[model samples]
Target: MRQVIVLGAGLAGSFLACRLLRQGCHVTLIDDRAPMSASRVAAGLYNVITGRFGSKTWKAETLLAELDAVLKDPFFQGVSQFIHPIHIYRPFKDVEEYNQWSGWSAEPAYHQLVKFEERPLFPEVIHNPLGGIRILPCGWVNIGGLIDRLQDIFRSNGGVVLQGSIPYDQINMGQKTLTWKGEPLGFDQMICCEGYRIRQNPWFEKLPVQPNKGEILEIESEGLDQLPFVITKKVYMVPGESGRWIVGSTYEHLFDDPGPTEAGRAQIEEQLRLVLKVPYKVVGHRAGIRPTTPNRRPILGSHPQWPFLYTLSGFGTKGMLAAPYCSRLMTAHILEGAEVPEELRITQFKAFRPT
Candidate 1:
């Protein structure tokens, strides 16, 4: 069996480790287990139609199908506790936007993904004067919970789990070896899925992965507890347990700190006021940096200089929906020498190639 060391235990790493194990590889998964890591703070939302224009996600059907299949697989059977299926309601800003959605809803491409409603679903609580479109196959996956479960499954399957970060200097690319704090590790290959921390990696640092910081808020609002589905306008509001609701997400390409900031909170509250009329109390706030690429596509494939080294990152805000399918592809690439799609291959970036 191929001996592999998968770095970072976030969604990407956890999924890849499990996939590698299933492919009959001996795997050791390492992580720093940072509290505010992106996967831990992610809303784990999977929406086929997203963005301000409501465009279809790239490979939405295939991604969603793989996600569903993985969730239902026997290996991840008990993860249903983290799976919450609900549609997303995007309130129309005006008559023109409503007309646009109405036309798009009947189009062949959107008919299966969205439906336009002429009448407001909740006028008292929402500011949808022009009605909205309900996006199907949309929901949140409790990513933190899913990762915990996957790690447990990995451990139960004889995969080793290591806690702590590996320093860059300890990696010997020339020798294709890794030593954690002076202790040498045995592995045939190393795959880095370090999320935003990828910027610190020497081998993959030049791949154009920008650290995009995002902040979110957890609020308690009895008025919103009855929300049957997620609501989105300037920001998204996902109903949680009891009277709690998950709101927010402010995207900041430039920031001074990685922790939650007052400015970020204000930005989220301002957007929240635009669509939600309910009163809420902020109970939790978090911040995490996502590894976003310029093209918004994930970066995957082997390192140009070191054939035994690889990276799987840049899933950005769509990591939850993309991880399952991407992990499978990475597994195949490593084990069967399958080629990664051209758009996602790190080779597309000249800097990622050998000098």
Candidate 2:
């Protein structure tokens, strides 16, 4: 069997490792389990129709199908607890916006993905004066729970799991050999899925990996938990278990730190107040740095100089929606010598070219 080492145990790494294992590779997965990692803090919201204009996500159909297959894999059984299916209610800003959605919903492209609502669905708790559109096949994944289960599954299948960071300085790489901290690791290849921490990698650091910081808040309200669906406007409000609700996510392309800030909290609360009519108490606050790309596409494929070193990252806020499909592509490329699409390849960036 081919021997491989996957660095970083976030959503990207975990998915890739599982895919590689199924391909009959002996895989070793390592993670530091850092505090406030993106996967852990992410709302894990997956929606086909997103953004201010409500455009369909790129490759939504294929991505969703791959996600379904991954979730149904017998190896990942009992992961249903992390999957929460719910529609997303996007409030219309005005009559013109409502008209736009009504027109789009009639088209074959959006016939099943979206539906326009002429009357306000929840006037008592929401500020939707002009009604909204309900987006189907949208829901939130408990990323932390899913990762934990995946790790357990990996271990149960005889894959090795190491808990700790791998120092870049201690890593020694050659044309056909690799070692960590002066000890040889007899692996055929190494794939790095370190997310925003990719900046620390010497080989893949040149690729355009922008770090985007985002913050989220958890609040407790009296009857808000009764809402069985997600609400969206300037921000999203996802209802969790019990009376707790998740409200957030402000994108900061430029930030001095990655930790939660009072300013971020204030911004989240400001947006939350605009949509939520009920009073709530802030129970939790979190922040994480996402590895985003300028083109908003994931960067995959191997290094130019070192073919054995590959990278699969930069999914940004859509990691949960994209990881499953991308992992399969990475696995095929590694084992079957398949080609990665140009748009998702790391070599598309000028910095990725070999000297």
Candidate topping lDDT:
1
Clashes of each: 0, 0
> Mind giving the per-residue lDDT tens digits that candidate 1 earns over 17-109?
999998899999989899878998887788998887888999999998998898779987777788788999999988888889888899998
For model 2, how does the per-residue alpha-carbon lDDT over 150-241 read when each residue is reduced to its tens digit? 88888888888877877566556654444555666677889999999888888887778899999999999886856768998898988875
Alpha-carbon error at 171 in model 2, in Å?
2.5
Query: How does each model score on TM-score?
Result: 0.97, 0.97
The RMSD of every model to the true structure, in order and in angstroms, is 1.2, 1.4
Candidate 1, 277: how far from true, in Å? Answer: 1.4
Model 1 worst lDDT run, 10 consecutive residues: 239-248
The whole-model lDDT of each prediction reads: 0.88, 0.87
Off by over 4 Å in 1: none
For candidate 2, give the lDDT: 0.87
